[model samples]
Target: MSEAVAPRAAIIRRLSITRFRGIGNLIWRPGSGVNLILGGGDVGKTTVLDAIGLILSPVNPSTLSDTDYFGRDIESGFEIEAVIALPVDSAISAQVRPAWPWAWDGKDAVVPALDGDSGEPVYRLKVRGTEDLELIYEVLQPDGSTGNLPVMLRRSIGLVRLSGDDRNDRDLRLVQGSALDRLLSDKGLRSRLASELAEAEVKDALGDAAKKALADLDNTFSERSLPVGLDLSITGGQGASIASLVGLTADRNGIPLPLASWGAGTRRLAALAIAEQRQGDRPVTIVDEVERGLEPYRQHALVEKLQDSGAQVFVTTHSPDAIAAASKASLWYVDYTGQIGPLDTNKVARHRANDPNAFLARVTIVAEGLTEVGFASILLRRALGAPLSQFGVHISNGGGHEYTLELLEALNSGGLSFGGFADDENGKHPTRWKALEDVLGPLLFRWPKGCLEENVFGATPEGKLEALMADTLGDRTGMRRQTLALRLGLDAKTFPELATAAGDRLRPTMLDAALGTVPAGREEDKGAYKSHGGTWFKSLSGGRELAGKVFTLGLWPSLKPQLLPFCNSVRSAVGLPSIEDLPQ
Candidate 1:
């Protein structure tokens, strides 16, 4: 017969916040592997994490003070509540069964509840405060009854929180609850260490490499020019010396190096390593900005570790790596506004995977391609004096015209404002183009000509285009700019029917072939072709820089027919008030 596994500690079954900080009321149900949180700054991301930590803590911890209150309003109260569920077959389960008899039928491991299962012997932490500053941390006890426990006597319920390094060298950060201290507190390790003080025992207990490695550190520090003047040593499992009971330190040319001496990224990884080992039976862990300071390689490894850690992990991040690391069903999206929910479907996941910052924005602007992205970004900054972030707008690359049309359709069907910019290439397919226009209406902005390249060159004042080409493209300009103009003129007239009835026919290759005559063998002047304004513009990864160059010369006037409609449509779609709507 197989041996029976012992039941593990409790996990946070569900979390709810009411009148807490900026969150008027919110409920979050997390996934078992990794609970992903998405949002931009000051959207109450940190507030949610802090509330979880605060409610789990004992009532009236000195850390709890006036600022803990959501706001100055005395009339409304603040409350944070969480359901902590213990395994039905665990040691604590038997004791609580008599008092709290409800049994959970679903698997009680790390995975989330599918239908919000209301299990029993489960405890609730209802931490509430009033206008008079009165506060209480009340939890339901095992006896199917409620109790207001004292701060020191409160239950732990296996809650762990990891904050980013913004807190700086605080000895026992919420990140790990003193990882070094937990290791030292281990009675078994302490007992073994007590028996060993020298070579014979140290080698036997720690293996040859670890024992020799520590000895080598001591010898190296004794001989080198020292900065801290302290020899490197490992902390023993005793209370005798504080550093000895704390953790490891090594020497770099006689300078003692502690974990704190490492770079931010290393420090983060190191801290997590310590926390994982020292975590004991804790089943729930919360990490903020899980990708902060981690390199691409480290991000992958760290994500794997988090997924396999067995503990229920909840993380908030804004990194493409982080998004791709977890499944869509596991991810949740939140904005600075009150909205919070899951991605829930694979399609939502794919969309978010393409743009990690999309879920974090208040309003999403789906741009047709890289050029359009650059152009839209530039326009927003020029008009708003800041990035679109100033107006709660975020730009997502639509990948292509078809993708833009699809994304706009999704946004419209979902009743979201359909904000998009597309190339004129799609206009050739009248049926699909009309359908897309119906969905996006005035919110869709199509360049009047070929693409951004055609629109930008066609709208620019004559001499300024040449001046820009000369200044920006330098030596490569003379041939390229002239050819770029010729290509634009060729596309000036449109075909009533697309030859192939697809976007490909709209590309330069096809149009360049049909545009009457040209300069002989210009193909040999390929260097110039690469530098042509339209070709050069298409090569750029960002349009904001180009926007600056053009506007600085006062080349493209603000009211150019091509520029106005695009700007107005995008503004309306993103909920930015027109100039007339501004306060007088």
Candidate 2:
């Protein structure tokens, strides 16, 4: 028989939060891969993750305690609101509103106003001193209206609140128990027996032995079908049984193993395995300080594992290694203002200059935001007719100045060339311009003659060439002003403008120019002209014409013999196919 396939876990498709403590309402679309939430402590990173859990699984009134894990009085009232992605069969779209039960004068009395529906049947719990909590549980009807809330939420709020901390609790065991465990328990058997008894119209047709046999059969079937084993072991003196699922297990040294007992990396690996096993079918897995308590090597392993798990993993870390391990697209930097924005990979590359590994190669363009990177790449590819990846470009979504600097340093150290692009920000200070020049040298190109930031796609193609030539040739003697000007079709006066216009376009053109290939032509004024009875040499005197032609008649013949080999070398360094087959 074919092996049974495990059911695919439900992914978190959407997370919406409204007015949960410090955070004003916000929605996040976490990627399927590890979503690293980089931020300082107390920036609502954990709160946002907790809100997700609370929305799906609210704390039960019976489970509430005066002194909770954080040691704060378990206030009788708290509000949590969120919309989670539910399984396809889930009655609700996974919307949840959980709150502490309200009591007035030590008597249980339902709040009358809470009984009224805003649109659908709204469940409300009014805790006297706290904000009124309302849960709108509705299902999409065939006629486009909302149906009733799920019976599970009405019966027990704990069904929605899958508390991470409560997973180890015994009374809370009902919530954390695996499907197999639920199938083995007396409760599950009793429920099954009750259903059968009701169906057969018999009070106790199924005896205890029959129930036990059914439970055993279910457990055996479940165990046979699972990809991994689950074992429970009681730790001596703690009165707590630790469950080992998947391939994880405590070392032979025993519980409370010494820090030195296992390799430094083992803890991170163990934690990662535990997280993956516990994640199950849940959508979001929030890990606090993923980089904390992990050594550098272990951190990389953890990042790889998280990425491989294909779950939405949110991690906060101060470690550069953790940031480096995260893909440029996956990284987010939390600012001092508590706003989380993506990191510019280029900026990150520049920030950690001392560490070579901090910089990433493979042409991943890092931009400050998703829109900028998306639009810019579209514009560049449309204008250039070449894949941006061909040029080793990556766009990083950076939060601010600090992130920008970090990216630049990281990239610079990694021996990658990157151009920084940012918004004009109401046309105030040129932030991107300053960032590029400070790290890469001076601003070689600016848009509209240093007015707006340089239009990266529109900049002349020769700038990258010029920068390369300047760096490689090391002197103006071989790359003479007049000769170079002729190659680029510019007089000395227009040379600066042309050079500034080159931008990234310069690199490829420089390679070609160095190999004795003529540069493309553009139109410019030949001489003074008169229009409609105007004087000669008028401002618009010059008619449309070729600005300048790259003089190759004698140039190629003179330079090819000496420059061909060098051109081939430059091409190889940049990972481009050789130009040896092309005509000199």
Candidate 3:
């Protein structure tokens, strides 16, 4: 058998925050693997990550201002607390082993009472900011005492935060609490460099001309009535060290290039690469807007790497590629009220596989297929006076008929507001439709009698049937007609006569061809009429064109009775006015 794998380190069991920026009160229990946060703009996704970083920041002096408080009300300062589970043999565990009283059984915090029974040791770390802008970071112990969370202990937790902006290359330098500093701490690089630089050998390394220039500079300073003489040493002035002055660089063609010279995306990847090189350290990585400045392929690859890195990761993203790449990550949905709900991955698997971007919107319209998605998106855009995204609404392809109902059920269970649009499928699965109807009410729209092809064909007026037929078959009418004639076993000369024969004969054949219900017996005969473009208006682009043509042909006024209520319900859901309330 293979050896047992070690438990992931720096796992945050639970997080609680109050009076933080843009978040009044919020609690989140992220998974040990990857916790992918998805939601609309200004939903506090970044604030959640900020709270995590602040509570565990190794920096002694964290920036705090009135704006950090919720609504700029500094009277009630913010508090962020988390119960972090540490590895038993980790350095941080050894430092806090004396006060480790709490235990985590993967769910709740437990206190061991049995004799010789000690559960997984955990710590309750908290950070509080007072009204005076003073911050306190401590660990609440079980013995009615609190201890200051020292910088050394916080650094052992290995919290690395990568923001979305361009100015995030601090980790590439040897600054205090930076990734490079931590990596070179045990090597005594600072003291060694300081000693070497202070010696006369370093000054000798300069050429004779440089040494003469330095001597002249010192003489010039003395002549100007200055009492100090300049020297090339490691120390600059007061409060300076070698670590603060040194940084990492990449060698290209025998030339050194600073990491800051790279693009934002390259710098982010380099920082993560350095963080990953730290032996025996599992960093709790928090990446905000994981898709910033990266192409789709890079974003997908980066997401996959983060998920399997064996370190607890938190990410916020608006890209579908990132969401799709993180198949094993837990999805968390944050609402407008700062309430976060963790979606069940099993239930949302279908939606994630089909249209992962739907989760990024506050309200999703689950359409039956691409046809319905295209039609609904355009119609809603025209009705809403802007794009649906302007109102936090997105129309998503539900994959198919049965999957549409499944996705709606899952969305309902996940406490996500959604609207549904699909065909009646000849009234199949009435129970499923009825169940969604009870919950969704007017937000759900389904055809009364048949599929999309049947309803549109049945609604077309007889006078407009010729234009509708021409639009349906697309260009190359002669070839399309000959193909239809061959499928129906008729002469080419009589094909036009048979195709537009009359009101009774014409529509039935067209509906059969569009719906792929021709030649009732033979399996190969099904969809035979459309095999050579007999009825081509069944695809996404075809549906969009059909919707535009239907409006231009003055058929929307008649079809509005079946479609208006759902549109108005969507408008109400996203805080838009109903059609009746809009100015005519």
lDDT value, candidate 3, whole model = 0.76
Off by over 4 Å in 1: 1-9, 58-60, 63-66, 89-123, 140-146, 149-155, 166-275, 278-280, 292-296, 318-329, 344-364, 387-394, 405-419, 423-578, 581-584
Q: Tens digit of lDDT per residue, candidate 3, span 1-584?
A: 12223366888988999999999987778898999998777778999999998988877764588988998888889999888887766565566445555666666555644563555667788898889887898887756578788788888888888898787777888878888788777557777777877775567689999999989988988999876567766664545467667788898789999887788888888888889889878899999999987899999888988987999999999998898888889998875445677877898887787677788886778889877877777677766778777888878888889888887887766554567889988778999789888877888889887866677777788777656656543564455455445545566444446555433666676555555455655566555544543244556765676677557777777678887888788777766678853222
Q: After superposing candidate 2 on the true structure, give the runs of residues whose Cα lies further than 4 Å from its correct spot.
A: 1-9, 58-283, 344-349, 352-584
Candidate with maximal TM-score: 3
The better-scoring model by lDDT among 1 and 3 is: 3
Instruction: For each of the candidates, give the backbone clash count.
Output: 1, 55, 0
Please write out the lDDT profile of model 1 over residues 294-380, one tens digit for every residue.
787787777777777777777887777877776522666664355566554455655776677776676567888776788778776
Instruction: Report the C-alpha lDDT of model 2 over 12-99, residue by residue, as the tens digit.
Output: 4345544455555455555545666654444556666665544434322223332221223224334443322233333233546322
Candidate 1, pairs of clashing residues: 235-244
Lowest summed lDDT across 10 adjacent residues in model 2 is found at 541-550
